[model samples]
Target: MLQSIRSASQHWLGKIVLSVIFTFLIAGVAIFGVEEFFRGGSSSTVVTVGKTPISAEEVRTAYQNQLQRYQAQMKRTLTPDQARAMGLERQVLAQLVTEAALDQKTTDLGLAVSDAAVLRAIQDEPSFKNANGTFDRTLFYQTLQRAGLNEPMFVREQRSVIARLQLADSIVSELPVPQAVREAVHRYSTERRAAAVLSLAPSAAGEIPAPTDEELTAYYDNNKASYRAPEYRSLNLLVLEPEALAKPEEVTEEDARTAYQANQSRFGKPERRTIQQISFPDEAAAKEARARIESGEEPFEAVAAARGLDPKQLDLGTLAKSELFDPAVGNAAFALEQGKVSEPVKGRFGTVLLRVTAIEPGSIKPFEEVKDEVRKEVALRRVRESGFDKAQDAIEDARAAAKPLAEIAKERGLTLATIPAVDAQGNDPSGQSVTGIPDKETTLPAAFRADVGNDTEALRTKSGGAIWYDVVKIDPSREKTLAEVRDAVVQGWTKAETDRRLVAKSKELTERLEKGEAIETLAQETGLPLKEVTEIGRSQSKDDLSPEIVERIFTTPVGKAASAPSGDGRAVFRVTAATMPAFVPGTTTDGQLVNSLRTALADDVLGEFISEVQKSAGVKVNQTAFRRALGGEY
Candidate 1:
């Protein structure tokens, strides 16, 4: 279903329908930072496309939205200057102008979108879906309200977008690509290639000696960004996991004996037998075979062989009485005498003959023998049952009394531990983790968000215990001193030196190859094994060689050596062979190539249509609004 939907979006008809629906549904949610910038009203217009007006408020909101989206995608915050450098503001402006132009064209053409179409599109939106997957009116209103648009205003915007999409789709739908063009695309995407790789890893240089103080300092200075510290918070943890709550000494002799008696079947094994049999198709056939065996006319093996059963099939092997889950099979096997063939008996799968070769009798250990194990299990169960209730009660009481975690722990027998300071990555200033905390991923994020004295909700662990914590303090991020990260500095220095040596070694080998020396001879000289990989496509991933090396092999001239950094070292390569598959006619064609080609053409047409509209109805921009969005006064 998903594949069809995806393919439909790529296909011409599906594209038109999906585009209309998509544009109608998503109106203001794509607007970046309305809550951040739309704090007050403004009368100024930022852009005027033909007769349509886009207010300064809209531009600011859109620009901020664009900034935030970029920041999220890049996973880093950007300053106003950095955003401008990335052309974020320009991209947002282009989008707004294009949309406004389309809206103007829709108005000029007098395109009419039915109220029912708009309503249906809105109702079908997944964002408005409730837990039962039906549209919830309350969520619809709330979502629009959050984006700073009332229901009427948002619906009006959607109506315009829908009309524009209808006009655009009519112009761009059914764009076609030639069969030869599609074949070319398929050949390029599916073609495979092979390479022979000789990886020169840092290990080839052997063990690296320790760096001196000067070398370490230089390495640290060059790579301070790698050592930059993350924001850290100090926290007080309330450990409520089963491992923390369980007490071994709580169980007594009486408890152990009671537990043992209740679950005795789990402790001791039952008598077992190694049995064999020949299955027959019917009662008459099995009875006939039994009679013949009894009269010595037909051997049991001969009967089984006549039925086309192998020796392994005839041997059922040793199994405990309880191991046979079917009651009929177990009953029949147990009733048979040792070394004697029994009469055909009815079972679940078919009729069966039985012979018990050996019987291993069962035995049970005395209560005293497993008492300690039973006592531990009983103690763990008791603690698990009581721990959560005890912790929750104490936490509530502490909240009511306005008492600290340390005080409550003393009063309620809870273990209270404090982490002085740990980064978001869960490491302290010395780069050691704040250990002994259960559910670190859950607890640490919650701790960072919490302020001192703010109570946190209980996070249940996989085990039946709640991990509770409170933020005690926040330690602002700062650059680490040389002494704090000396070990890391030394390690970096050693790696740099090793990589340098390896690169020099690789350069020597490449130079030798250039002088007509074979790679096999070079491998022998360097005491490294030469490896070859055949028919490796560009998509084939290699653990020994980095992606750069694989790409280099394809691009490198067949005889000329190319080098790339490989795992702190370097790899030298020369392409021995290259083959590009011919575009074969009549390969599989399931509309995939046509879909991709149509999608590309349709996109270009839509883009050109929007641009033509923008050109025909020129956009007027307000410089004041642009500067204000870029941290300037209006």
Candidate 2:
């Protein structure tokens, strides 16, 4: 049966949110920000959350950002084609759709966070806490700036993020699994069945008949998509990885010595000192405490405690100059000789009285002690230099030669490898399979673009490490010859035939049922066994019916028939009987286990809601524009 045409505005809105439900709605909102700016025509919006449109640009940007983040986190680089093959693009856009829906929901409900709340949240964050244990406004501003968000925009965005969180919380909090329901679910989950095992192996039936040309053709026609070869790209790339140019074993004693000597300041010892502090709630109290300490009878600890001050609270430890809070404090502490007490000094937080407890002079490690470490650094540097020289030579040669890429690679002792095909969308032919030569990274260059953007000349490109590539061949997507797709066409035809037969059978059964045929008799007539589902509730049928199937079953009246031709010509069913299953108290260990199992199972499936806002908005992607944006002449 065809899926119901979801023409309702709510249903379409839900679809948009379905795309980017993960980054939450914030990503969708951000996508909403720059989506309209794309040149040519805007990419279709998969979803829209509210009146805010989420275009293809939004999904694409979000996807690219997500991919880049993933690459950076994994410390790997992806070729343009490799990224597409992995369906990083589609998956990313899908997530954006989810986000778009959530965003719409948020808007519909009028959920919002205030700017002040966002500011407070930022100020309260421990990461922004400065030495004084308070949110340093400057640091907070600077950090936001570093994150590419100015104060106002960050606060505004953060407010929205918090609002979205509130909405999520409301959704989650209201989703309660009742105790009785949970227990019942647990029982079903723990329920075990006894069965006589049987195996029907295809191998046991030796030499299965060769499919007739008609059967093959039918199968191929039915499953043509599966058999069509995926888009493939052959690319040449240039890469510059630090490891490729540097080797650890190339440092000489002289090189090590020279390296260590030239950078001796970096290896020098930190100057150490001791200091004391007198902290107070107010500067007046701190000044008075200092005065008493200077006047001599009051011990620093006693005076501090009498003033209800914590002596260790504000004290800078006996630390190296590099560790000191202020340059003045460091200078004064280091200047004092051993056992000398210094005058009271005013500092950032409070007045401080300093005393030099002991002086530890700075010293560098002996050359012999650090020789090994120095040698490693020197050797690595040499390797990098040598590698760069070699890479430069290769680039020069490639640039000068009209020779084939394979020959150039062979001459330079580099292996030539082919990259998997990427579609105009930059998706891989394999659809995100992790299997490949050199495991994707070594084989794919960061700049391995198949389109080459109208540039005919092969240019040097650098990726994560020293791996370099030369574009050998660029194969554009083209209609395959019948010979190439004959097998696929046959498979598709077979599947289609199977489906047609199943549909006819289902229709015949439905007509018989309408004519007063019983379900048991129908089951016997067909080979499908009746599934004896006892004491089953709508929730317990989660495994049997995914959310989609479960919803359909519940919507059907108890006595009404509900059957759908599922995948591979399989038909599904739900039988309504005069007698409902009654709960049986625990009679054995297995029964008790079943009860516990049901409860645990109930905990697993709860609170799933979606809104598709994009379809409602009638978003359309300009495929031509998208390909152009991808630097491809589609």
Candidate 3:
């Protein structure tokens, strides 16, 4: 069942099972003579591992799930070409092949789950339980039906999954990590250092002379790709949102009244009372307590206090009549006047005396009082429920009839937005950000992928809207003339020259500091400000020191100088001190680091085990079948 699968995915055992399966499936197993595998005739089987065959349908299903996951993560739809370029098809095939190899190995080893064990696993699943916490046969069957599985199929799949898990656990569970390994990791993560740093600004390079026309032209030629334009598409988009389409003015009085009458609960509040009660073992005890309160020998609070119940324990807060679990107690509580206590009443749990401290009478707004609000609600609901679908159908009909999107939008009183030109990143030719594109993250990618005059599916927006777009024209990418980008070329040439000079200058200064020159003396001579940074960790970066500089500092030995590129300049740093903090045992941090190392070690062992299994069993792929599974030609 889908619910059971989801619930299992969150458990530790389930995570391990899934991790092992996916690890083998997508580990990029080396295939020998791949081209020869494509020479065979087409078959429904995509791969064969030992005696087991992996069907193309299985690969197709796995690929589609993988594709949907990727789309969800990226929040955008990918075209077929994009998917292929991302090597999704190859990954999917490799995953299935590896899984099949493992399954074959499990079979050879005589690993199997008993039918009783499979039944127990299904019965133990929380998703199949009823309200009383017992497994429900109807719920179990219904869940399997929704998941498109029969009892036999589900039981078989469960058996296979458990067998695979057993194989993986035998290889990876209880694997030990060495104490030295934990110490090494801790030292690397906890080491700290101090450094003397001097920042070199662009001015330190000292005025890069203007480039010659020839030099600029040479730079432009070398970096022509940087100055080239990206392909752009001009699109006509028609977006329909329910809220925007809803016309409150069109809603009649009759319609508003009908909606108001149909949804009375939405326009009114039920009467509520602040009540409290004290339960007794029997009706006699409840009556005795009420009699004592009535005789003024003890108040309700005193009586509750005598029973060792606090005010909070006695108070049930405010509630409507339907909120009370016991109808007898609810009726008695509501019938009592404010500041009055009722006689003993038999409730579902036991006999109880009820008290009402406050009452709030329910009220409903008249139709005339909420006419406009009701009308707006009805209009929006209509558009959301049915109007949007009808409008989409009409637009689709027009599109099927070969009518242009812009004309159809105009005829339907919808806004037709025309993007003059936009690139894959939603940027115009001038590199300015384009605005007003609905669902830009999903739409732009789909638009750039579609060809002019092609029928493309409408994209759905996050706000429950649909966007239909037509590619009007596509501008092919081309190299810009040198004259057209002269300014950018000159700027690039200057920055490159400046960086070269800065590197040389920093190298010269670094050598002097490393030899014998004091950092303060060099700072005074260069007229650059110098600062000392202390307690810099391997993972930390300061405002003046970037992560790269921090890494350089750690790599440099004490009393040595290193240079790294900084923001628009360079920084020469000298290591002044290095410290390795004492590693405390049994701390939370130490435990976490040890556990992570253990997990990594286990993964390595598991990977090696699977690799050996694949080698022993022998794996073969039918490249033609694999390609066909992805709807592609070999």
Q: Give lDDT: candidate 3, residue 140.
A: 83
| Candidate 2 error regions (>4 Å) | 1-20, 23-48, 55-64, 181-287, 291-364, 367-441, 444-464, 469-607, 612-634
1-634 in candidate 2: lDDT tens per residue? 0001111223222232222254333343243334441223334544433465656455555655666676776666655655666656545544545544556667778877776787776777665666657777667676666555576766655565556556654544334334576456555444432111111122222333456777675555555566555446655544444454555566777878888888664577756766665545665665676677668867677875775557665356668876775666677677877765555566555556566766777788777888878877776566565666677666557756655556656666655655545433445654564333332443443334434432343322233244444444466555555568775565555445556656656666667765667767776665455555443354444334444334445555555555553334334454453233344445564365554543333223211344334444323334455554444522
Q: Measured by TM-score, how close is model 3 to the native structure? A: 0.76
User: Which 10 successive residues of model 2 have the least lDDT summed?
Assistant: 1-10
Instruction: Give the range where candidate 3 is weakest over 10 consecutive residues by summed lDDT.
Output: 32-41
Look at candidate 3 and give me any clashing residue pairs: 25-95
**Better structure of 2 and 3 per lDDT:** 3
Give lDDT per model, in order.
0.70, 0.53, 0.81
For residues 134-216, write the lDDT of model 1, one tens digit per residue.
Answer: 67887778777666678887788767756866887788767878877876777656655545556776788778888777878
Error of 1 at 509 (Å): 1.8
Q: Give candidate 2's total backbone clashes.
A: 83
Q: Which parts of model 3 are misplaced by more than 4 Å?
A: 1-13, 24-47, 54-99, 123-146, 242-390, 455-457, 583-589, 618-634
lDDT of model number 1: 0.70
